[model samples]
Target chain A: MAIRDDFEVVASQVRTVVQRFALGLLVIAAFGAMLVGKADTVLVEHARVLALDVVSPVLEAIARPVAYANRAIADLREFASLREENARLREENARLLAWQTAARRLENENEGLRSLARFREGPEASFITARLVGDSVSAYMRGALLNVGRRVGVAPGQAVVTGEGLAGRIAEVGENSSRVLFVTDVNSRLPVLVERTRERAILAGDNSPRLRLTLLPSIAGVQTGDRIITSGHGGSFPVGIPVGEVVETSDGSVRVRPFTDFSRLEFVRVVDYGVTGLVGTGAAAPAPATPPGGTAVRSR
Target chain B: MRVDGTLAILDRWGRAALPGTVLLFFVLLTLAPLRAPYLSDTLPLLPVLVVFQFSLAAPERLPGPLLLAMGILLDLLLGGPGAPVGVSALGFVLVRAAVMSNRRYLVGVPFLFQWAGFCILCWGFVALVWAFTTLWTWALIDPVPAILQYVVVVVIYPLIAPLLARVRARDPLNVPELSRGSARPGETTP
Candidate 1:
């Protein structure tokens, strides 16, 4: 028994030693991967998308019940004011009918005007529909994981929106997934124009629910509850996408409340405008130019 | 339940499983997209607390390898463009290293000191991450969000600590086999 006890002690010590060595190796490997990822983010992105694709099914299965429960709770809240909601919807329908009639008349006039002006149109836009599968939106990081990615032609800098209005832009793309950086992310900024006044300003995110509007001309007229839309100055997002509405605050600090509630985001459309803006210009290339101050020469 | 005074020793796999499961659950919690207003920026430091509590009180189950894995996984899940990854792993290691140094004495310290220690560690970790992120991006990210997260984590720690203590208590497999004084891996004693 004494001999057996001594052998067990020795074996246990050996196991402990081996585990420590393995632990050290793993820590080193993990940190090494992190550094490599920092150096070349694409390497980590490939692995991330693969893992995301594998886990997407599991995450969806788990989220179903939570969505169901949330819907039920929301239903309960709405049920309490069903009559008020019906009246509100009726009023909105009436207003929309009037707007629709006006929009048709304006559309006819705009087409005539464009034809007279002979405007040049760019390539048509397409969209990729993706579900909001994961909410990795934290204070420090304001991005959500989408279920569709490169497999479906999703790419970085694509504009993501919901039925309500503009939501955010795709910041990174993976093979089977992507990350959408919400407009409220501190790192986000987009040029916007107020609808009523047509005044242009900068919409800046501070990781808050309300985005700030800055750089408006001192003479620009601003009002609370005014609509805002993308100015499309950078040629990334297409022009005139509804962004948000001006917020009411007593401090005279301008803020716009996003139309889409990010906390409750479930799905979004990723739009491909096909204009990368990387190329110097879209104008037709100049005809083969002669050598400066010299006649063109034949080359071998 | 015990038949007499003898505790039931967990099998090898069983002994290694619970802490991992718990830590993983916390990781999932960290990644879960909660839909509350202002929640995106102030998720309680659940993963950090798990590492701190388990590393301090239940190192037998949560060794260095598991902590490292948890950290790496968190880094992947929590990062995007302009976001720092690997900070979570670094933070977890920092806390684990701190705990390992004085774990024997810390194993049974009053809850207050543990809470205090966790707050300090969290603040330091946040600062380190913010600094690292600045250097990586060559720009200064607004520190307001990180500071707010630290505040939220500190405020919620007291309420969450008791439940974590209960979890640590349930992991009594780490308890010594006092009766035999040298129980083997598979053996059970008082």
Candidate 2:
């Protein structure tokens, strides 16, 4: 009985001491965490990148099923709507056939004109097609991953496009997967021109839905509804590809409605133009002409 | 010696089977990508699972430290910011303790009442954390969708709860019985 009483007394005393120490520790920990939170944004971003690198493959593996299931559900819903869609498809098909024939005829005529005029040969480029794997739904960084990666010849800085127009470019490349920075990403910029007026401007995205056309001189002849296309000034992307249509906002700033709907992206083509030496060659050709012109101008 | 023996048994079972099965199911569900996008947009099911695990499982059966570790592992697997999970899980355990303290009142209450109470507490905690982090106003201010999602989860809770409960009850290692002893200071019946 005596021993039991002593044990109880000691236990109670120990508990009291431990509880007080724990309370003190908790207060210190809370303050420390707050300080760390304030001071560790860079560390946190680094940790996030490391974590993403580690988890990306697993997430991609998991995302495949989710994407598949979503597609399956969509297919089921489409089956229900198929009867209504068939009649529309028949009429659309007929109209498209006529347009296709006219397009073929024009293409043939353009080839004939090209052979006669001896137009300069554009850089030889090849392309590989890939399927989009996953994307972020949140508003901040709009990007997606594609199944094609280094193994499939996709490289960072390579341009990605769809049949409609420019989608984005490969930002990060893995062995079997690559992340594409969509034109809507805040960091994305493309040198574009107005197809109608040849006015050059920089298209920049600000995490907003619309892309802004910056660096436009006040007197530049650009109008609302003008078509924007690549100018081929930069070797990164080929010129003459349709980008988007221009729209003048209420604030008098111009924005382009991107041709590709990022949310619905599925398939894309990665162009491997093999034009790394073309820029140097073009620069060298201009130099030879410059020396002759300089001597002639001096003699005059 | 008795506690060591019990822990040995739990270690064997935990290592041999339980965690693997749990992990496998989680992976399968993730792979099945069984997503109700519309449902998830409004009500996240993963947080509800976390809350449920805290409430129904005995604390001694799953120590706070172990729970935190599991939560972190889950965060890594789920590919999100990792530390929020550890913090959220600790919060869940604290709330569970508060609720379980009034077991007499809660036990006698209808299952629906219990679920509603549990969801309200969970949502309140989640909203508070989200607000503290300066998330968009739409996250916390829009209560209609939040409540609707909460209700959907609560409605489905009964179906999922029993399965997990059965798994806990049928655990061959008897970790639950041993853990219950250390749950409270006065408890001595293992």
Candidate 3:
């Protein structure tokens, strides 16, 4: 009995020592991984995509129920305000009817002019609707994982949008899953034009709900509610896609609130305008056309 | 007699593996699409709480290698351009280190005291992650979101701690440690 007790104690001590050594090694390995991730972005990105692909199926299964639950909750809320919503929709429908008639007239005139000039058409825009399987949107990162990827021709840099307007663009693609980098992420920089004034600027995200407009023309005037749209300078997104409206303009800094409701995002349409300029095919991003009185910025 | 011994060994191994397995599940839970405004940002910290609870409950079972794997997996799931990937692994190790250093006092303390210790340590971990992120990006990051996440975690801790404590109480190894005639609880071995 005495010998057995001694053996157990020795074994315990040895185990303790081994555990300590392992803890030290793991701490070092963690630090090493951090350094490697910083140095080699491609490796990290590949690993991230692979991980997403592996987890997406499971996320998809979970998303269905969660999406249903969210819809139910929204429905309950909407039911409480049904009368107000119906009245507002009725008013908006009447306004849209008048605009629809004007739009039809303009389309007819534009089509006649195009044929008379023999104007060549740009690459046709195509779309694939995908369900959102995962959401990584946070204060630091704004991204969503989709169930569609290269298998469905969902390439990187394709514009992602909802019925309302622009949401984001594809940042990474795997076999069955892809990631959308939202317009609100710090790394996202988009070329936009103030629709009313036709003045160009760079819309930059700083990991905030509102995006900031940078590189604005010094002489250009912008208002608080000026509409913003893709300038089509960058071939990644189509021209004139409604992005957002300027919510605030103070001290020469303008903030935009995107039309897409990020919190309630469930389904998104990925648009392929067939222009794989910078992100998709490794071609250089085109520089924004410099209007007079403004320096041009690269649309990246 | 041999069969009884085999069953005993299997039970011990199963118990040893439980905490790590549950922690892994918590990691997966973080990625689930439970969409709400500001939810994705705050839910990432759920695994951190799991790590803390398991580190206190069964430090031996929840070893460094498993924590490293869990953190790296979470990093891979969350990582993207401009996002720190392996920093999560570093954070896990740091949390483990913090808990290990204070294990003796924490395991012996009352529930309230343990709760308080957890609050302090969780805040410290959040601050450390914020600092690392700011440094990695070399830009000034707004601290409000991280602080809000910390607040949410603290509020949710009470609901989670008792459940983890129950798991600890049911652990077979826990009884042996208590009966080892140690002056305080959880001081049998480091």
- Summed backbone clashes in each candidate are 1, 0, 0
Model 2 agreement with the true structure over B65-157: per-residue lDDT tens digits? 444444333332332221232333344445555455544434334667666666766676555444532341122232344345556666667
User: Against the unseen true structure, what C-alpha lDDT does each candidate score?
Assistant: 0.70, 0.55, 0.78
Candidate 3 displacement at residue A126 in angstroms: 0.7
Predicted structure with the largest TM-score when compared to the true one: 3
Top model number, DockQ: 3
TM-score of each: 0.78, 0.57, 0.88
Candidate 3 docking category? medium
Clashing pairs in 2: none
Per-candidate DockQ values are: 0.31, 0.11, 0.52
For model 2, residues A53-94, the per-residue Cα lDDT tens digits are: 554566567667777777888899999999889999999999
Tens digit per residue, CA lDDT, model 3, B77-151: 875565567677777887887887776667756888788888898887788778877777777888888888888
Q: Is candidate 1 or candidate 2 better by DockQ?
A: 1
C-alpha RMSD (angstroms) for model 1: 9.3
- By TM-score, the better pick of 1 and 2 is 1
TM-score of 1: 0.78
Winner of 2 and 3 under lDDT: 3
The most accurate candidate by lDDT is 3
